[model samples]
Target chain A: MAIEVNGKMIEIDEEGFLVDREDWSEDVSEAIAGRDGIELKDEHIGLIDYFRDYYEEHQVHPTMRVLVLRLGGKIGKKFHDHKEYEKFLYMLFPSDPISELCKLAGLPKPLPSEHDG
Target chain B: MAKKNDEKGTTNPELNIPLLNELEEGQWPSFVSDLKQWSKTKPQVAQLLNQLEESYENRWNYWTGTVLNVSGYGGGVIARLSEKADKYPDLAEFHTIRVIPPPGFVYSTERLRNLADICEKHGAGILQLHGLTGDALALGFDNEGTFAAAEELMANGWDLGGSGPALRSLQCCVGQARCEMACFDTMKTTRFLTNHYISFLHRPELMYKFKIKVSGCANDCANAMIGSDMPIIGTWRGPMQIDQEKVAEYIEEKGVEHVIDNVITRCPTNCLSLKGKQMVVDNENCVRCMHCINVMHKALKPGKDRGVTICLGAKRTLKIGDTMSSVIVPFMKLETEEDFQNLTDLIDRMWEFWNDNGMDHERIGEFIARVGLATFLEGCGIDPDPRMVQSTRTSPYIKFEELAPGLFEGEQTQQPKVWNREPDTREPSD
Candidate 1:
């Protein structure tokens, strides 16, 4: 499958995940987020950026335990305990935080077998 | 292992494997799409991938076809012609039939070969070895072909598998027939259940499907622990059989320290102890996890006085979260026909309750969650036992004597205080 952005064809896979990683841009993120009825807030963008950076470092998707520990140091404030930040995270993405972030970050859809962070 | 970015801000060519790089970018990259794209040069593989992708993408649509209902005593024969019959003319005869095998799935090699040959003659030369239940599926038969296959199967002493909202094929682990640890005949109990509920197997009278799985021992290789509605797990009540001579022989060959470190020390509940030259087991503390017996098979064996532990409410998360069954019957002797009758009666009572009260598509576990465990127990005529208590209690509350004093003096004539009343809005604002 392919998505037409500004009349330029950008390739994607069957599940609407980007086929090419380098094809990602801020415009692409906005378009993807719009599809899921999510208007990207500044914090949402920050999360997506963080996820992309983290994914670049780690080949495998991080579990919730790894996220809570790493995000505490990187983003700090109220992230000291998982319970403190969990409410806010869910508020930002009602379905799944990782799924929403990944979509906006121009990544593939997580497999049914994949565990969420 | 963070790799450095090039001056051009793109990942280095050496670091980029298209599929691996796609997977690293925060999503589950489609290997199917990758395979299709990679096999562009290979037309045959690409064509096969295209067929598979089409089947996946439009699966729900393809599943719809002529629902062939056989006028028979059994229920699980769901044979449907593929909706894609028009597009793929060769697939016009594509009909799948799910066939239930005998309990313990004991099939002779010749019988299996015969079934395969029958499938090849009528349908596509394939058998789906495993289905959602214990039944095997024969895929790719036409209307006429499927009937012929079913006739052959019946003639060969095979019957249709269970389907619809009914009892599926009862699954069981090989019991005393093969395994040394088996307490009772799992196959015998399974056959009894299957024969008695044979009519229920073919009828869609219930709200949802019910599964009954039996395991010969606590090792639970059959996975009845979390999958079945009534999970019959075998357990030993008496102390484990410990051969002193065998233990001495093992110790002499493998060393006493080795036995203690490897076998005795590994007991999860610390129920096993090595005293001088004898091994002692604290039977009360034993959880019957089958770990120790598995470790030292020569010296240790399951107790002779064996039966089954009946558990209820095991199912996948639907309305409620995924729940493992709670022990309803701690231990029950299954040797006598009367005992087996009592067990079947319990199952019937539970099913009757569920059929009456269960919502559409609601599993028994979900129904129990909505109605509460106490109600379910009462309906099933089961007395409440401490062993039936579930571990996931949200309220960790214990009432004290001091708090109980208020219960006796509950009817005090004191007027209740009220606060935060809304201001009177009867008059219009000036």
Candidate 2:
């Protein structure tokens, strides 16, 4: 399947992850997030940037705990605790923060395991 | 779907399930016989039996399906849809609902009957006394029936067990209820943990399935040491109490040779010795392997200072290899609420570290292997201890930088530094 962004057809997998990483752009991310009724905010973009960078370096997506711990250091100082930061992240994404950020970052769909309920 | 006979009347007239029939011929109790009995009343069981027979004949499993959890819960239902649904329509959507049994599996007859009624009403009337993880398995339900069964179970003050990536069912060996050697209350611990981590049990958020098992004593009746990610085994500190009179009595009853061959020789640490018909244990050298104590139960009793030993990273073979639990906390008093809170705090640290570093499909044991035990310990805020290792370090390649206090920070050593040590403070050799 595919989604149209900037009047160009961009391919996505069945779960709506980008079929090709090279096809990713800011416009494509916004278009993808739009489908999920999420408006791309600076915080969301910041998380997306972190995800893309981490994936590029480690060849694996950062888990939700890692995202909260690492990014909470920078942007989460206002929150009372790491859990509050995590709750804020949930408020932004509402659904699975890691997967949502990864999708907006235009990375491959996170591998599903029996543990991924 | 109400319970009904085969709608198509396609119950095979020439049902040739030789292998399944062979199972019924065994002397021991046979699940095949039970299924055959249930099949007389439940068509679902008949279809399941037929599917299993076909699977045995084909040498392949016919069960396949997707995750089908009840509303607002992530686990406790294992979906089982037969690939040959066209041939056996009744087995099309047979799923298993895992019900969390009471701690130590003590069930009242009334409670058990309630479970049976629910199974009969919404499932195939099939029940497993206990699954591998200690949950009562209610088998054979479709999607809608699964939700209905769960609702009934919850209404009856019962909850579903763990599935998927969540914390799997917590198991505990019968403690003070029946066992004299029970060091702590295993059932109480199980109940406490179950109530505390109820969300983790129902919510699938962990990197992989986390299992907790509590054994009343080092005998490990629950198989916690090798089967679970977190193993809480009852142990004691200080010297074990020895009764010389009972020892003499045992020696007189069992004979010298029998005692020597069976008890003395079986001491894994060679800490026991027969001194004039009385057994003497070298307390310092004893490793508490439980062999000698088990044989001379009347003579040897556990130390008064009883506590539990907590271990981590035990799991079945996956990724790295089969690994036994490694001691993290050698002994911790599990009697008071404060002690339980401490344990939960440690568990929280462990979960946080694992959730951050663990990969998909990677168990906590595998994660420890990948990240190194030191890093894991650091993440969990635990100090390195000698008890955590099997033996003294063989390799000298230690991460001294991490261990040394303020050495890299350029703090000067104290006056009694090792290199610039003071002269012997002890008086001349006497």
Candidate 3:
């Protein structure tokens, strides 16, 4: 399916993941968020940026477990505890934290085999 | 649209049963009209229609050249749609339907005809009466016409069976409905639970498929003890009723050896004894198998003041070996709506605990086994009791902390630290 972002048409798959990864921009993420009934808040944007940066560096989306460990061990400025990070993540996105993050971050839907725990 | 078997003239057993149209005039009336009326609000009818149509289309491909391969994670209705429906004209829009029956399945001829008529109008005019789950399945249909067929089915009052990791239709024995030995209302309990958890029946987000089966008494006609995730068994707290006059008559008519060899000796627990003319029952030792009662139906009967014994974590082997449910609530009266609420609450707590902690594809029984029974009981607000003991090896072992000063030392005569109670150590309320 195609979504119009600032008068530019961008393609996405049936599940709403970005069809052409290079076509993604902030405007594209906002359009996707609009379709998902979620407003792209400052916190969500920060998390999405973090996921994008992580993906760009590693060529793979981080699982929830890796995200928690990274936040607690190295990226400890915002949240030091894994449990607190999880709580904050859920506070931002109630259902399906990873799915929402990937959608906004322009990442493929994580396979069911991949654990979010 | 019946598929031809290798034997050209053979009739399909699944499709050919007691036909609805051929029944006697006064026996039962057609329910197709009733089904159409009921279809207005139920959304599953439309969904099932789409699935069945897809399945029929897939089957056509299988018959011609392509292999019908349906693979997935969840268990529910196994729908097959042709992968290359656009390429093959004959395969387009076909679908299959599998329907699971409720516990103690008893359907009138009219009801069977209603199902058959729905299939005949929309599909290949075939029905598989006894599927894997003992459910009725309609084999073939096309996408364009199946919706109307499903709507009529719903109007006639049929719900899809449970599939996936949700609760299956709660199975129960024919309890107080007909049986004299029944301790509780099995039918009422089954209906209430089925209706209350209907959404859970369709949704498959849980760890795995969960089943609840109820038996009116320990005879376990429903086979709940070994098969279900949760088994509710009926038990009488009192002794078995014995008619001394009938016992005396039996002794005189049949001889003392017969009663001694058959009824008294057959008690599995050795709980029965013949004392002169009276038959004595050690109620405490009785397993309630109904063996003696079955042998001497006229002479013996079940006691009054009946209630249910709830067991948990009984299931077939998956990750662990096969295990029978251990008595959770030894006994509870399942009478009022409040009592039902309590039962549901217990179930809710168990589901929440299992869902939160259980791994992907793990069963509730497996979760209990992994976490240990003590942890489960403590999490569910149940106190540790002797009745809750499952095995000597796995039972809760007391960890002895260092005794306080003067306890079990020097001439201190107070009760040992083991017997010392905590503030909330009282037994759990029924």
Question: lDDT of all predictions, in order shown?
Answer: 0.67, 0.79, 0.65
Ranking by DockQ: 2, 3, 1
- Please, what are the lDDT tens digits per residue for candidate 2 over residues B11-96? 53234578899988747999888878777777667778888888899899987756565655657888877788777777778899
Best by TM-score: 2
Off by over 4 Å in 3: A1-117, B1-76, B81-103, B124-136, B141-149, B252-254, B389-430
Error of 3 at B260 (Å): 3.2
A best-first ranking of the candidates according to their TM-score comes to 2, 3, 1
Provide C-alpha RMSD values for all models, in order. 21.1, 7.5, 11.9
What is every candidate's C-alpha DockQ against the true complex, given to 2 decimals?
A: 0.01, 0.14, 0.08
Q: Once model 1 is optimally superposed onto the true structure by TM-score, how far is the C-alpha of residue B209 displaced, in angstroms?
A: 0.6
Runs in model 2 lying further than 4 Å from the true structure: A1-112, A115-117, B1-14, B390-430
lDDT of predicted model 3: 0.65
**A41-83: candidate 2 lDDT, tens digit per residue:** 8888888888888999999888755665676756543212454
User: Which lDDT value does model 3 have at B153?
Assistant: 61
Candidate 3 colliding pairs, count: 20
Cα lDDT tens digits, model 1, B259-309, are 889888888878888887778999988888898788788889999898999
Please state the CAPRI-style docking class of candidate 3. incorrect
Candidate 3 residue-wise lDDT, B1-430, digit = tens: 2332222213211221123223333556544333223323322232333333444655442322111111111222434444533333334444555454655566778888778778777665656655334457665555444555555666778765455445665778889877888899988898888777764553334567778888999889888878888899998777878898888887898888998998888877788888888788899888777888877778888778788989878876668898887778878999999999888888877776676578866778788778876677667766545456454226533323312334445774543233233334457645
